[model samples]
Target: MKQGTKGFVGADETGAGQGATGRARVPAQPGAEDVGRQRNRTRGGGTDAVPGRTGVDGVRGERTHSEPALPRPLPRRPVQRSSVRGQILAALRTALVTGELRPGAVYSAPVLAERFGVSATPVREAMQQLTLEGAVEVVPNRGFRVVERGDRELAELAEVRALIEIPVVLRLARTVPAERWAELRPLAEATIRASSSGCRATYAESDRAFHRAVLALAGNEQLVRIAEDLHRRAQWPLVGSTPGARDGGARLVADAHEHTALLDALIAGDPDAVRSLMEAHFTGAV
Candidate 1:
């Protein structure tokens, strides 16, 4: 960024998605590719961020869903015969986020394939990809088991998000057309409304949409894709057994309000304010 004195020097990674060190956790899992193309947004939980330098190389291979945000993953029909691998990956991610695939429960590729009405190959491949995200653990002579990530991981994930998202947004505040950013207001407002509604899933999806809209301003598809992957990671479900698992409506409302403020700062083209706002948003998140 030329000693941090540049104006929108690089594309901002905003998405329909990651934490600082950990990935941006989204709900109702979808393939990284599908998340990118569909611009799926998600709500995140807390765990320390484990920043991964994941890019959008393989994910961009096949662009999928062009549909609006999904509240949950719908089962695929048996006759569907498109990119089967991507479908399985997306399905597993949805299962993971929605608690259909329980943490600590063992699931074999064949069983999951049966559920999705596909072959075992894609299911195994998708599970392998998830293994890299620390979403599941592989066992000898057994299938994969969902991994339980803790708050520490979520915090680290937030850190990674701050590193990736904040600066780009700040630059965008300086360089991007104010009108362009302003156009995203509806999406941001939807997040606030969803948050205020007190439904966790709706709020989560809206939250992801708002963030995705924010980064879309940079006009960089790849950046958005990478950011979306990170976002999904951060939104992965938290272990219910964890102490202090709070999901009160008050917190969502407050977070939604912050989203409004962040949008205002961006639309106002206040880079300094945008920086502070982005920082507060990332750090304040669990």
Candidate 2:
């Protein structure tokens, strides 16, 4: 993150008020105060995971879903060997993204273990993973605190996504087989289902799946993995939000349509349209 805004080196205009001589005077240098303010105005501000369930802080000051509570229990995972950690990770991510695990709230692994009905081992393991993702911070003796996220972090995540996916997606669109593109339509549409149902957990998975599926078409595992990591971070839940003209979840619904449009553009092999769509989708609207 940027630490501070750079100081202005010159004047705003070439006039120091209309000169008495009918000629504009050379502008004065920026005042010390102005220079200092500009230099420090910009400052640094403060994770990826999966979803387990729905909307949090839908309408703050009314009823904050996260206040005084842990997130709802983890979603059920399909039985598989060594799946406990994955399930816990998914659940924890969902809780964070949905405001279930309120930002800045510290939660012990043992407590989280109880919430998910699991042993502390997996819970702690899962938290360590999150720490690597910058989603949580370890307290000396307390536990993990869900790192607070806001619009700035969201924008940075989007920027990262834009940087990584734009060129790759454009290339993939031009070269991937039409049949392969056809196979991805359902995955893209999964966002619509999650949006319509207003299920945050489901939406999180579907959203991640859509992006991953699309990027995977490029046949680059490393690229796809990096993109997925950014995608997860971009979806991290905000600590608070400014009341807007639209509801909080409006962007998610709109994104479903955006993904569909993008898929169509990709299938058509219109690199221009694909580029435009990808740029717009990362506007942090959701």
TM-score of each: 0.62, 0.68
lDDT, candidate 2, at 244: 26
Stretches of candidate 1 exceeding 4 Å from the true structure: 1-84, 196-202, 241-245
Residue 93 error, candidate 1, Å:
1.9
Tell me the tens digit of each residue's lDDT in model 2 across 176-285.
Answer: 87788888889878889888777666787899898888777777899888888888877677777432222666877898889889888877878889888889988743
lDDT of 1 by residue, 181-279 (tens): 778888888988877676655666777888888788778899888887777777777776321234556766777888889878877777888888788
Model 2 / residue 194 / CA error / Å: 1.1
- RMSD of each predicted structure: 24.9, 23.6
Q: What does the lDDT read for residue 238 in candidate 1?
A: 72
Give the range of the ten consecutive residues with the poorest summed lDDT in model 2.
42-51
